[model samples]
Target: MGEKQPNEQLATWFVRSGWSKGELARQVNRRARQIGASHISTDTSRVRRWLDGESPREPIPKILSDLFSERFGSLVTIEDLGLKAVPNLAPGSGVDLPWNGSQTVQLISDYSRSDLMLNRRGFLGTSLALTAGSALIEPMQRWLAPAPASGGLPTGALATARGGRPPTGRISPPELALLESTVRMFRQWDAQNGGGLRRKAVVGQLHEVCDLLQETYPADVTRRLFQTTAQLAHLAGWMSYDIGMHPSAQKYYVLALHAAKEAGDRPFGALILSDMCRQMIHLNRSSDALELVHLAQYGSRDTATARTSALMHALEARAYANLGEVNKCYRAARLAEDSFTDISVPLEQEPDWITFFSEAELNAENAHSYRDLSYHAGRSEVYALQAQPVMERAVELFAQDPDHQRSYALNLIGMSSVHLLQKQPEEAAASAQQALEIAIRIRSERVNTRVRKTTAAATDEFRGVAEVIELRDRVKQELPEYTRNQAV
Candidate 1:
């Protein structure tokens, strides 16, 4: 037996009018239909099998050849059908185009489409770090710190509508339709499942909508849409981070931040900043994360919502905990708790974004913060127990709507980590394994990273167990290179 070459298959098809196997199958089915053959059928899977060198069932192969010959007005053989292979027929391996205006448009369109496809499942498997290298970052840095705007929006007209949609009109029909669709979709998914399943799609769709809005709407209308879109994008990015597409996720976060600024929503901007900082903490860049938290605090100062303030403080506590600054972590955690004291006030007083925050939610966050501090302080028992209840609550809340895969994944990771700390190796392994399965299904790097960390810790406690060792090894193999280093 020998390996079959792809080019050989492609070449066979080239001489027969360059029709692909799938195309040939369609032709065969069509010809069969003309002949009044009963039960005529063709499918991608069968065509793919033929392309892989399997012989066709019966009259199908000859029928396909005849159909192609008739269509092309010449003799067509199976060999000429290029069924074996072709020299340059690799999927997604097209030649690169020159960077220009046209290319940029194509890039944006293709990227959007790719994102849409990928979001339907999990994070796109490809790494964005290589693509978003220093080259991209340098320009982005320059743009972020542009000299005082000369009577222009911070990001220039990038945020404004170019001619696509008028900025005013009592919620134009199309705009209302779009808004309702987005809200309904998001709420439905959030309620039914969790963020894991819908986060990527939500974000990708929001980005696409934002792109369209920028191309069409007026400033005021665009700004409002942009704000909501940015929030969706932020959630998508968070889900991406949760699932494990750090590079692309970071890009989305940055874009969301810019969108938030354009909408003149400082609170939302601060919230995103806090989220970005949390990612840094996960990466062990605690010092850098601390700085980001400070920035978030500064940006959110004038925010009227107690929940928003509490969220910022909670983020600060996470950074401090990561830094091993127990006192600072406690102080920040306490600030977060105090902020929630006024959360019971009138709903109108709270910001739209922070309206989801409640006393139970704040308590859950506090519990997690304490657990983080405990981890840094080497108080395993206390950390394990303190984190248990809140983690349980999160799981319960998230499970109420199974579609929120991202939140479910996060809670699972947290619970797994706590179980590991309690030296419950079996329970820890089970939790970690479940999380890993979800992570793999969604192709999320963040969830994988968390699972890897927890599994490694658990493995140390059950070094002699074969199942534990095997699971640990599998997790180690699955984690990204960057995460492996951080876990160590």
Candidate 2:
């Protein structure tokens, strides 16, 4: 038989609806229940077949039609959803949305719907649902390319060519202040309370801000508006990452990148790139992370202030750490520290989003870089001991700030790892125990992840010690999957 035709139209609609095939299946079952019908095998597999152009028989076709119609907030038909064999319908195939306000609005709307409503996990082929339809990390030039003449944005907010003047219905100072304040609060909540608290509400707020940007504003206010929007997008991205939603997190980061570029805040754009580097490192794509660091460097260009420069090098140190390039990591670390010395007013003058980058963060990167280096060079007491003081200092700093509960907990775990490597099982257990206290109180899974690693280290090298064993048991109780990965 000849190959079956693919229905890109239905795929787009599926992405727009923010519904995964599995979600579609589940919704269909519920809608079926409303009609008092039972026994339908409307699983993801069946939905996949329909996407591949197999017609659904009779009632189910109409049922699917209704489901998508409600999701996209418009009429949909069996034909639209590929219930019948059909050709691609959405014009020439491409996922790139031209840089404009309406496109940006739709992007955020679809992303929010997918995240808040569908809570989608994997979207493999759809542009509307996943990165498949999104641009991968682009070069700095693409991001820093000339802004549109009209406010330098496709969604032109009439900017002042000379002295800044207010436009009618322009974004007021108070409104911009509120946006900045919201991002600040969200940042605090993310560090102290956990990203899970009202994250969906933040996404909702992003939509509101996105709507605000659609309107024209003064040149000065527009710049501030873009800056504010970028920060919120970054927050949305960070929260999504904290909860293990990698795809959604990446989308938010990309949106943040665009917003920063649109704002013409070169420093903020570099910051976004640095943030992306961190995410890439987490995903184990060190090479990609390195590229993002370079992009960040280029984005900063000549106008990079001392604080921004410090952050860039510090972020580079992290990527180097991931690559196990010890010498390069050290070089970057030194540059970061040196750059910090040049900053004026330091954290007080730095952007709120980046104000948290201090000695503690630098120390953490050092500890991680050295730990990774030791893995390849053969473990040494000297290596472990050196990392200890850095981690201890970091832990001290984070611990003093109660709102940074998760960071404090993870740093404690980092300290415990060094102690473990040095054969100080008692110290290791105590440090891990302290970390556990914070982990239990916070909602971050990442904090739990660190504790699990600490538990693994304790059990692997010092199984005979009672305190170590006790620590392991407690960790297992806290994270049920903690029992499965005991490998060193």
Candidate 3:
């Protein structure tokens, strides 16, 4: 065999991380454990081999990329690490490319079609690497520019025999309204039920809408059609995320952002970016999430209504709380509350999408932010104590709506975490049991994920307790294998 070439790129990132070889091995193993890959144990010698130019297997390159991305608060792909020969462990789904409005439609059609195919094939995990939120900053900046006027469309439904090919069919206002109504129905279902039951349905609907976009319409109708398309794409993205198809979710979100821009709905675009920020936070990239939210807030400052502003601030609080910034978290939470109180628009006047950010939703965001704060505050139980009343109020409000089971279930998990932070094992277990009961009824993988995380915490805290043991057993039986593996 010839002499081996050193992996300079890997060596550079390793030096930048300032972690010893052994520490790198430990972190790799820990990350593997989080993903239920219990078999991935490496020692310092393995790390040395990697640095000495031996290409690691399928997951190590991906895992190292993720680790370095989180460490550097930016994207670090496999190619950046000089491990391009290893099969890419993550999926992108073409979200990183720059595309025009027509290209955006194609992207949506391609992504949703593949999503349906994967679902039909009984695929559980998506073969996608999530695009980092930080990587979206420049694209969002471009989206902030003024949208071009929707001119040059046919004035009436009749297709003019110009030099170009005519549209497939004419889209009327009634058709646009029907599509809008369908989006509303899908939104309500997603809110009440998790994304699993109807995700495929949403994707199918999105495909239909994309096809409709090819039809002829007046400028006003065309704008509304794109608006409806944006809404459908955003819902599809959220459902994808809810079902744990995270890479697909990221792609759909990028598509939604593009559609929203084409529709000239700056506020809605900001909302989509905020939702993307929440996903980043879930992926343990709070710094990137914080930056993304700031971009959203800044970009929509003029166009965002009071309700949208409140929701954005609440999400900002969530990112801050996850980052352990106590003061910033509370400050953003207070801003959210204040924004809600200052709403000048009537409930009926606000957009259909922002209408859901009512007082109950704000309270839920605050409750979650406070619960996260409790964990980050170290030994202090003050934040934990503060979380209870907010959580109680949220639970009370959410309980009033029986259809809002997923929200209710999530708050229960939050409440349980607060109880755990306060050293109330019995209360924590009780709340967790309640959450699990609700979670099993819901079809949301996100709820199942919460159950897994909470159960893992309960197990760690009350290792020998009968109730916690039973909770773990129930989770194993109810949740999927991936979730069950992570719960341990």
TM-score of each: 0.59, 0.74, 0.80
State which candidate, 1 or 2, has the greater lDDT: 2
Q: Compute the lDDT for candidate 2.
A: 0.68
Error of 3 at 202 (Å): 0.5
lDDT of each: 0.59, 0.68, 0.77
Tell how far residue 426 is off in model 1, in angstroms: 4.9
lDDT of 3 by residue, 1-488 (tens): 78779989999999999999999999888766655466889999999999899988766777787678656645677788888634443343445545356667777877777666654532323345665544566666676665443232222221332323455667666877888999989888888877877777888999998887666554566567778878888888888778665666777888888888767788988989898888887777788789888989998998899899999999999999989998899899999999999999899998888877877789989988887777677735888888889898888888887867888898888888888888887788888889888887777877887888888888987988888888888888887543312210
Ranking by TM-score: 3, 2, 1
Per-residue lDDT over 66-96 for candidate 2, one digit per residue giving the tens place of the 0 to 100 score: 5664344334656667664233345212224
| Per-residue alpha-carbon lDDT of candidate 1 for residues 1-488, written as tens digits (9 for 90 to 100) | 68654445534554446676677667667655543453769877777666665666545544555455435433344445554222323332222222122223233345456676643322232222312223333333322332234222323333333433343334575865677467556745543343445664575667566555535345556466657766766766665665445544565666666656656677887877777777766655677677776777776577636788888888788888777787888899889889877576686676545655555456556667767767787856876687788777876676564554655676677777777677777777777777776666553445565677667667767888676787788776765443211210
Using lDDT as the measure, which candidate wins? 3
Model 2 alpha-carbon drift over 4 Å, by segment: 1-97, 120-135, 139-141, 150-155, 159-171, 378-382, 480-488
As a whole number from 0 to 100, the lDDT of residue 236 in candidate 3 is 83
The residue pairs in collision within model 3 are 90-128, 90-129, 91-128, 91-129
> What's the C-alpha lDDT at position 133 in model 1?
23
